[model samples]
Target: MLHIVACIKQVPDTKIIKMNPKTNTMDRASAPAILNPYDAHAVEEAVRIKKRYGGIVSVLTMGPPPAVKAIKKCIEIGADEGYMISDRRFAGADTLATSYALTKALDKIQKIKPVDLILCGKMTIDGDTGQVGPGIARRLDIPPLTSVKKVEAVNQEEGHIIVHRKIEDGYEVIQSSLPCLLSVEKEINEVPYSSFPNMVKAARYEPHIWSVDELEDVNIKQLGLKGSPTIVAKVWAPPKPEGGKIFEGTPKDQVDQILSVILEKNELFQAKGGY
Candidate 1:
């Protein structure tokens, strides 16, 4: 049976998050935390693949204890198992450090059951760097196929898979050997509402929780903030745009009103020597 592992994360809902004006940084408290949207799609796709070919879909994540909620969310989406590596040392990790830590956890999982395929979201909504997936692929020395829009086939006996990779104009069909990593696009699959049975299972699920110590061959210097090298010079929210005027009238009248407003603005600009 295929053992597919999908990497996931719990992130602050960016849509509802607010920025701190004084610190010019995100006010994480202002928003509720949820499973990363892109990662959800990745988990959904993995579950779909498992349904197509007989296999177990497992999800892995790294975060605080509360992140177990994210794992439960994955279970609600039909994942067979969930693993989370949580520890205080993993706090404040940048993408590079995060990848290093996850790789160690993956090594332990591999020992338990040989992984046939690894799937990841194209990018996390909070970070948007889209680096960790490729970073893990590089560390494992496996082929990383990114921007995958479709999984055409997974030939287990032949030990190969075919996928449609999204390109500028359209998509390109590419085939790769097994044990490859795919960073999938959201369009690859539609995530449906969780089934009642899955929801019941998720409610009672308790994922395997591991600390940094549980992972084998871990580098203490590469676990968290201490290991991160990327320096964020500053973080600020874009200035709110000025409110717009409402042109209330028929189409022809609105057109005339718009032209009049444009002329008025032009005259003011000329008066102010704005050319």
Candidate 2:
């Protein structure tokens, strides 16, 4: 059977998140955490592939203890197993450090059962850098396919997968060998509602939790904040723009004001095919 691992994350629901002014850090307690939206799609895609190709789908993540909520979510989505790597040392990890920790866990998972493929979201909403997927693939010495829009075909016997990778203008079809990493777009698949049985299973799901000490071949210097070279210098919200000026007076005056403003930026209009 094919073996697929979907790497997912629990992210603060940024839609309702608030920022702390004193420390410039997110007030995570103010917002509920949920599985990363794009990662949800990645899990959905992995489940679909398993249904089509016959595989064991395992979802993996690195976060605090509460991150098990995200793993159970993958179980509801049809993943057969879930694993989490959590420890105090993993706190304040940048993408590089985060990827290092994840790669170590993945290596350990590989020892249990060789992985045929790995899946991930295009990017985390919180980070938005889209680097960790490729970083993990690099560490594993596998090809990295990013921004995948669809899976065109998978030939297990031939040991290859074809995908539509989104580009600036359109998408390109890429055929990659097995043991590859894919960072998928949200548009790749629509997640189905969990079945009642799956819901029950998710509720009772117990994920394998590993700490830094439990992971094999871990370097003390590469497990967390100490391993991160990049540091946030500062963070602050951008200044809000001034309110728009009201065009009052006559209808003709308003029309003239609009025309004058348009004329001032005539080049922009021309660039957009305006007369």
> What does candidate 1's lDDT look like per residue over 135-183, in tens digits?
9999999999999999999999999999999999999999999999999
What TM-score, over all chains together, does every model reach?
0.89, 0.92
lDDT over C-alpha atoms for residue 11 of model 2: 97
Which whole-number lDDT from 0 to 100 does residue 126 have in model 2?
82
Off by over 4 Å in 1: 244-275
Candidate 2's displacement at residue 251, Å, is 4.5
State each model's CA lDDT, in order.
0.94, 0.93
Worst lDDT run of 10 residues, candidate 1, spans: 231-240
lDDT of 2 by residue, 108-204 (tens): 9999999999999999988888999999999999999999999988898898999999999999999999989999999998998999999999999
